[model samples]
Target: MKAISLLGVGICGGALIAAGCRKTNFVDKMAFKSAINNYYSTRQDCVWPSPVKFPVQADTSNYEQTKGYDALTDTGFLVRKAAEKKRFLIGSKQVNDYDLSDKGRSSWTAEQTQPGYGNFCFGHREVTTIDGFSPADVSDATQYSVSYHYDVAGVPGWASTVEMKTAFPGVAMDMSGQQSAVANVVKSDSGWQVNSVTPTD
Candidate 1:
C-alpha cells in the first residue's frame, strides 16, 4: 500500500509540473521581451529627403533647411557649399548646395520606386528591461500594456554626433540611454505578440 501511495504522489507531482510548464504564455516576462525585440528588429532609423530631391540646394536664408544639412555635413554624410544660383525669376540668390559624401553613398539605400530619393538608416531598438504591465488577468487576458526600457542597437558613429542628435530629435531620444516605452501586446494562437509600441509620455 505504501508503494502504491508513493506512485500516486509521483503521478500527481508530474501533473503539477506539466501544468506549471503550460502557464508560460504571454504573461511571462521572457516571452514579452522576445516579442518586443522581434518587433523592434524591423524598425530602423533613417534620414530621408523631407519633400525635396537629393543633390539638392537650400537657400541660406532657410535656416530650418540649412540646419539639417549642416548637421549631416558634420557627420561627413553630406557635403555642403555656398553658391549663388538663379531662382525662378528672382535672378541669382545665395544658397547652400548639398550632395552625398563618400560615406553617405556607402550607407545610402536607394528608393526602388523613387529614382533619386533615399534615406540613411542608423539602427534599431532592443529591450533593456521589462518594467511593468497592466491588466494582470492571467487566465483570460487577451492584451497587455507593457511598460519597458529600451536602447538603440548597432548605432553608428556618424549617427551619434552632437549635431545629428541636435538636428534630429528622434536620434537624440534613441541614444539617450534606457528610454521607457509602452507596448501593446495581444494574445495569439502561438503566443503573445507585440501589436505596437510608443514612447512613454
Candidate 2:
C-alpha cells in the first residue's frame, strides 16, 4: 500500500509540472503577440510632409480685392503645411525613419540603425491588418520563435518629391503591400521583448 501511494503521488506531481509548463508557454505566446502588435501600432504614426500644394497670390489688398485667391488652393496648402510641420516636429523621436517609441526603441538592433536600411525616410505607415500568426515555438522558458503576416500602407513625406528623389535616388517613396516575417521574442528584465525580425521571401 505504501509503495502504491508513493507511485500515485509521483504521477500527480509529474502531471502538475506538465500543466505548469503549458501555462507558462501560453503566457509567453500572448506576450509575444502583444509585443508585435504594439510595434506595428507604433509605426502607424510616421513623420511626413503634406501632399497638397498651396497657391500663392501676389495680392496685398483687402479681403475681397484678391482676384487670384482660390479657397481650394489655400485650404489645401494649409492642410499640407500643417501635416508637414507635424512630421518635422516628430522627427526627433525617429531613427532610420522608423518611429521607435520610448518602450519599443529598446528592440532596435544595430542592423536596423545603419544608413539606408529601412524603406521610408520620412512618412507614416498604416498597418491595415495583421493575420497569420503561427504557433510559437517555445525555445525555452524565456524565448519563443514565431511568424506572422501584416499589411501596410505608407505615404511618403514631402521630401520624397520628384526633385528630391532625383537628388537622392536611394530614398524610398510611397509604399503599400503585405509581407511576412519571423520574429524572436525573449523575456527580458522588463518583460517579453521582440529581439529580431527577419523577412521571409
Candidate 3:
C-alpha cells in the first residue's frame, strides 16, 4: 500500500510541474507580444515628419534656431531628431522612462547628429500587416522570442532631389520595403522590454 501511495504522489507531482510550465509559458507569450506591439507603435511614430517650420531669418550663431532651419531642409537633421524622440520609448542603459534626464537625452542627440551619420531618412512608416508571435528557444521565463512580418515605406527626406519633382511638388521620396524578423523580448523588473531585433533568414 505504501508503494502504491508513493507512485500516486509521483504522478501528481509530474502533473503539477506540467501545469506550472504551461501557466508560465502563457504569461510569457502575452508579455512578449505586448512589448513587441509597443515597440512597433513607437517606431511608426518616430518616422512621422514634424511640421515644417523655417526661421524668418537664418541665425547660424544660435544653435537652436540653426537646428530648426536645418531640420526643414536637411533630411539628416530630421532623422536625428526623430531618433531622439524614439529613444525615450525604448529605454537604454543611459536613457529610460524613469530617468530621462537632460544629460541622457543630450548624449543620444549628439550621437544622432554627428557629421555624416545620416545616410537615409524616412518620412513615415506604415505597418501594413503584422504576423502572429512565435515562441523562441530560450531557457528562462525572462527571455522570449517572436517573429513578425511587416511592410514599411521609408519616405526619402525633403532634401531628396528625386522627391522634389513629385507630381505634388516638394513631396518626399517613397521608398517602401517589406521585412520579416525575429525579436527577443526580455522581462525586466519594470516590465517587458524588447532586447533586440534581428532579421530572420
Candidate 4:
C-alpha cells in the first residue's frame, strides 16, 4: 500500500542452514541431548527471567516480556537494536519467550528438526493466498523451529545466530528495488543476549 522502503517499522526472523544435506540420525540426537544435558547440568541457561508482565494464558507467568516482543522475545531484542539503524524492520515481528530449561535435556530428534534443523525448512512452511500483517493473519499458521542470523551490526561474531521454536510465520518484505531474501534476526532467551540485528547487504 505505502512505500515499503528499507525503512519500515518491522522486525524479522530467519534460519541459517549448513550447505548441503547432512541428515542427523540416532547418534546426532544422542549427542545433542548430551550437549544440552551437560550444558544444563549446572542448572543454568534454562532459567526464565522474571517477566516485567505476563499473560493470563501462560500456564506460568514468570517469563521476561517486552512491549512488542513475542514468544521469541529473546531474539526480539536484537531486532529492536537493529531497528535503530534501519526502518524497514522497525517492528515487523514478535515471538513468545520461554525457558530453554537446563533441566534433564532431550534430543532435538525428539523434536525432529534434523537435516535442516536451523534452516527454515521444516516448520510452518506454508503456501497461503493472502498473508496479512496481523496476529489474526497467521493465527492458524503452523509453528516451527528456524535458525536465524542477526547481523544488524554488520559484523560476524557480534551477530546472534541460533535455532529457535517460534509461533509466528515469516513476514515478507516488499523490497521494491532489491533482491533480498526474506531475512531477519529474532531475539531469544536461549541465553545469548543479542547486540543488534543488521541485515546482510
TM-score of 4: 0.13
Candidate 3 yields a Cα-based lDDT of: 0.45
Best by TM-score: 1
Superposed by TM-score, candidate 1 places the C-alpha of residue 66 at a distance from the truth, in angstroms, of 1.2
Model 2 whole-model lDDT (C-alpha atoms) = 0.43
Over 1-201, each residue of candidate 1 has an lDDT whose tens digit, in order, gives 999999999999899988775654345877889999989898775754242357989989988778878888887878998899876877888999899999878988777687887888888888999998887656467888899999899998888888888788777887777589999999899888999888884
| C-alpha local distance difference test of each model | 0.82, 0.43, 0.45, 0.24
TM-score of each: 0.75, 0.35, 0.36, 0.13
lDDT of 4 at 116: 26
RMSD of 1: 5.9
After TM-score superposition, what is the CA distance of residue 140 in candidate 1 from its true location, in Å?
4.7
Question: Over the stretch 1-201, how does candidate 3's per-residue lDDT look in tens digits?
Answer: 999999999999899987774533334455555676667665532222332221134334445444433443333232221111223667532211121223323322222444422222234333344454544343366666667654444443343444233322223222324556677777788788888888663
Deviation of model 4 at 181, angstroms: 24
TM-score ranking, best first: 1, 3, 2, 4
TM-score of 3: 0.36
RMSD of each: 5.9, 16.1, 16.5, 26.9
Q: On TM-score, who's better, 3 or 4?
A: 3
TM-score of candidate 2 against the unseen true structure: 0.35
- Rank by lDDT (best first): 1, 3, 2, 4
Candidate 2 lDDT by residue in tens digits, 1-201: 999999999999899988774544444445666777666555542222212111222223333322212221222222112111124555522111112233222322223444422221343333333343444444356765567664444433343445444433323232324556677767789887777777674
